[model samples]
Every structure is written in structure tokens, then in C-alpha cells.
Target: MPHIKVVGLGGSLKPGSASVLALKEALRGAEEAGAHIELFELHALDLPMFVPDRAPPESVQRFVDSVSTAAAMIWSSPVYHGSMSGAFKNALDWLELLSKHSPPYLTDKVIGLIATAGGVQGLQAINAMEFAVRSLRGYTHPLTAPLDRAWQLFDQSGQFSDEATLVRLRTLGKGVAEAAKKMAVLG
Candidate 1:
């Protein structure tokens, strides 16, 4: 089988945030599943707000290109006010550039959704992302990781302290890569 690429996008502006750490762990699972992985931390990307009529910036172009070429993706976001962070949403907005691609926005791509929250609203963010994935014409893995009380899951060093949750996140990643491979063969 040919190698597949999995792109990971999301994370809060705070460095080493729980959401980012979770994303890394999930990407590790994808790598173990024989897929190449690329991560786009929102803080590093510093993407500007989407302007419908304006040309995309270099960072936006790079992000869109990566998403366009990837066979699968893992999105991890921190829930803010019962939804995904604004920066994460803005990054998704940049995917509008992919509308001109031959297959268009996320077509044929499989996505895994993960959301971390201080309270119990992580699932809300995941639900919100599901709508976006559908709008982009992508398939989402049935296994999703909605990490509630994210602050307690990580240690002082930002590593996941809960083994079960960690395993769930990794399973989500592996599921996405495996699904993407099946889709590739079918398509």
C-alpha cells in the first residue's frame, strides 16, 4: 500500500496547551499506523481572520495545501464557550481556498475529531467540528475523543496522565488512518 499523509490542525494560542499535547499523541498513533503526519499548531500558524475577497497569506496557502494533499486529518481544539476556539475556526475558514482544487474542500479525506475542555463541553466542540467536516465534504471517523476536564488529564509537564484517555485518542488517530487507507483503495 502507498504511504498516506495525515495532517493535524488545531490547538490554542497557549504554548504546550492540553489540546496541542493531545493532538501530538494522536498523530503519534497515525505515524505508528504507517502514515506520515504533519501538525499545524494555531499558535505557530498565527493565521489571520479569513477575508473572503482577499488573497490568502503564505501561511494560509501552506495550511490549505497540506490539508488538500493529506489523505486523513486529526483536528484537536480547546472548547471555548461551548464551541471551538476562534483561531481554530479561522483556520478552517482558510480551507475556502481549496474550493478551487479539483476535488474541492477535503473531498475524499477522512478526519478524526478531538476536543479538550475545562468542563464537560468538549463534546459540543466536536459536534461543531462535525458540521464543518460535512460542509467540507469529508468523512469523520466514528471514534472521537472528547476530553472533558482537560486540565486534570495532563501533568505539570503537559503530558497526559490518564492512560485510558490517551489510548482513546490514539485509537481515534489509528481509526482515521485505517479508514483513509480504505477510502483511498476504493476511490
Candidate 2:
């Protein structure tokens, strides 16, 4: 029963973004499930636009390295327009650095999707992420957290006011860790 690593990636540029708070809450569930967790906030990462054929910067390298080593991942993003934020997408694009790894991009990794939106389109971002997860050769958990009207769930201090949403997000995280553990045993 070795501890698995669960990487949480995403967040908006805003200081108290609901997506980031949700990501942290989800990672807390992973921790409770006996998995080690690492979070890569998009704003802190400051990833540049993905430009093919260019060497990734040191930050991108670190991000990719963590993702490559993780047994499971939980991705959270703020839905902008009809999809994930540019920063979130840019962070995923940086994962191209893992393309040349031993197993390549997200091979055999289990991913859980979460998205926060001001409107009811959060599921759109989750769908977009599911497509990307497939392209990366990762398995997505059946349960997803598409939090709509995200602003209403959090207070000015970024505290989650909705207990139900928190439970759902945490459940998604626990599901990912449990699935990843099963995958590890099977593999």
C-alpha cells in the first residue's frame, strides 16, 4: 500500500479564484485517502503560450516532471467563455514536455475533472478537459465536479459557503485516488 502521488493543476489569475479553492479542497480529500498531493496553480506557474519546437522553460519542466511522476491528477479550471481558461490550457500544453518520456503524456494516469463557472457552462470546461485527458492517454473518473455559479459558492475571503459542492469535489478526488490505487495494483 505505497502512497500514490496526486497532482492538482489549475487556477485563474485572480487572487481568490473559486477554481483554486476548489482544487485545494479536492486535494485535501486525496490527502485524507493517504495519497501525497502537489498543486500547481496556473497563475503562480505563469506558463507561456505553447509554442511547438521551443524548449520549455524551467517552470514548465518542473510542472511536467510532477505530472509525469504522478499516479493520479485532479484538474480544476475556471470556465472562461465556453471552455477552460487560457492559463489552464497553457499549463496542459506545457505537458507536451512529457511526450518524450518513457510512457509519454499521461500514460496510465487517472485524472479527475473539476470546473468552476460563473454561469451554467462549467460542464463545458469539464468536457473540454475530458477530451484533453483522452488525447493524453489518461483515464478520467466517471464522477466529475462541474460547479456552476461559482461566485455564489464562495465568500469574499474565498471560503466555500456551499457544503454540498465541497462534498462533491472531495468525492471526486477520493474516487480518483481509489481508482489510481486499483490501477497501480493491476499494473
Candidate 3:
């Protein structure tokens, strides 16, 4: 079976947030392209600020476990004030904890980054986030989905109706899906 684990980090807790919906769409497209996709909400994995002595919570472990086991992952978040949300950053904080000493937490997980913002330049935020993920030893997919004026991109059903937007999202999903499959097979 085509097994892929896709995690989407919603940058905000706002109801009907476009970030979450777009993430879901990416996951759906991945599945359609022959992947078993699971959407992980960063909001649900609440974590205390990363500290030296603090251990990971059960939920955080769950997230780390998913990353460790998945051959591929998709992390999408909306830009918050020109950067990724605190909640999303916090989740990565826990991931950082996995990298104590010379050990790596993300080892070789292939990742796809997505960002949604009110402006077309939201990919700037995605670029910043990609740097973080790469630092943890994760390989990032060059293909990205940075939605512009994302608030108006989706409808009430959380569906992206725009033609070009949908195409980009699908391309991202397919690319990640293929990468995940290859990563799993090679290793």
C-alpha cells in the first residue's frame, strides 16, 4: 500500500481557518495520488515551551513518533504577523528536543512546506519555516504552496475553487507523495 504521513500545522485557532482547509486539501490530493495520508493538527498537540529539563508530553511523543515513522510529511501553516504561528513553532520546539547532542530527530524525513497569508509574498514565511525543518535533518520538497489572500481562496466548504491554486496544491501533493515513496524505498 502507498503509505504517507502528512501533517498540517494550522497557524491559528480561528474557526474555519483557511490554513487548515488547505492542508486538508493537500492531504486529500496526496491520498488520491496513492498515498495514505493523515492530517496532524498542531493545535491538538499542545506543548509547554521547550525547556532543558522538561520531557516531551504524550501528545508530543505521538507527533514525533509519526514523523519518525513516516517516509514523507507535509507541513503547512499560515503566516502569523509575517512568520509561523507560535503553536506551530511550539510543535517544532518539541521536535528540537529530539535532537539533543549529535543525534537527529528528523533524520531523513522528506517534507513539503506550505504557507497561506493575506498577501502573495507569504512564501517568505514558508521559506523561513523550511529552514527550520531542514536544520533538524529533514529534506524539504522544493515545490511549495503559498496562498495569497488566502482568506478568500476557499469557500464555506473549505474547498479551494481557484484553478491555479488547485493545480499548485495538487502538484505539491503529488511531488511529496512520490518523494515519500522513494525515500521509504531507498532507505
Residue-level lDDT of model 2, residues 36-97, one tens digit each, is 99999888988889999898889888988889889999999999989998889888888888
Judge candidate 2 at residue 12 and give its lDDT: 96
Q: On a 0 to 100 scale, what is the lDDT of residue 179 in model 2?
A: 91
Error of 2 at 97 (Å): 1.1
Better of 1 and 2 by TM-score: 1
Winner of 2 and 3 under lDDT: 2
lDDT tens digits by residue: candidate 1, 74-184: 999999999999989999988989888999999999999999999999999999999999999999899999999999998877688999988998888888998998898
Error of 3 at 3 (Å): 3.9
Q: TM-score rank, highest first? A: 1, 2, 3
Model 2: lDDT to the true structure:
0.91
Residue 17, model 2, lDDT = 75
lDDT, candidates in the order shown:
0.92, 0.91, 0.75
* Candidate 3: C-alpha RMSD after superposition: 2.3
Off by over 4 Å in 3: 1-4, 100-103, 156-158
Worst lDDT run of 10 residues, candidate 2, spans 149-158
- What are the candidates' C-alpha RMSDs? 0.8, 0.9, 2.3
In the predicted model 1, the residue pairs found to clash are none
What TM-score number comes out for model 3? Answer: 0.88
**Regions of model 2 farther than 4 Å from truth:** none
The candidate that wins on lDDT is: 1
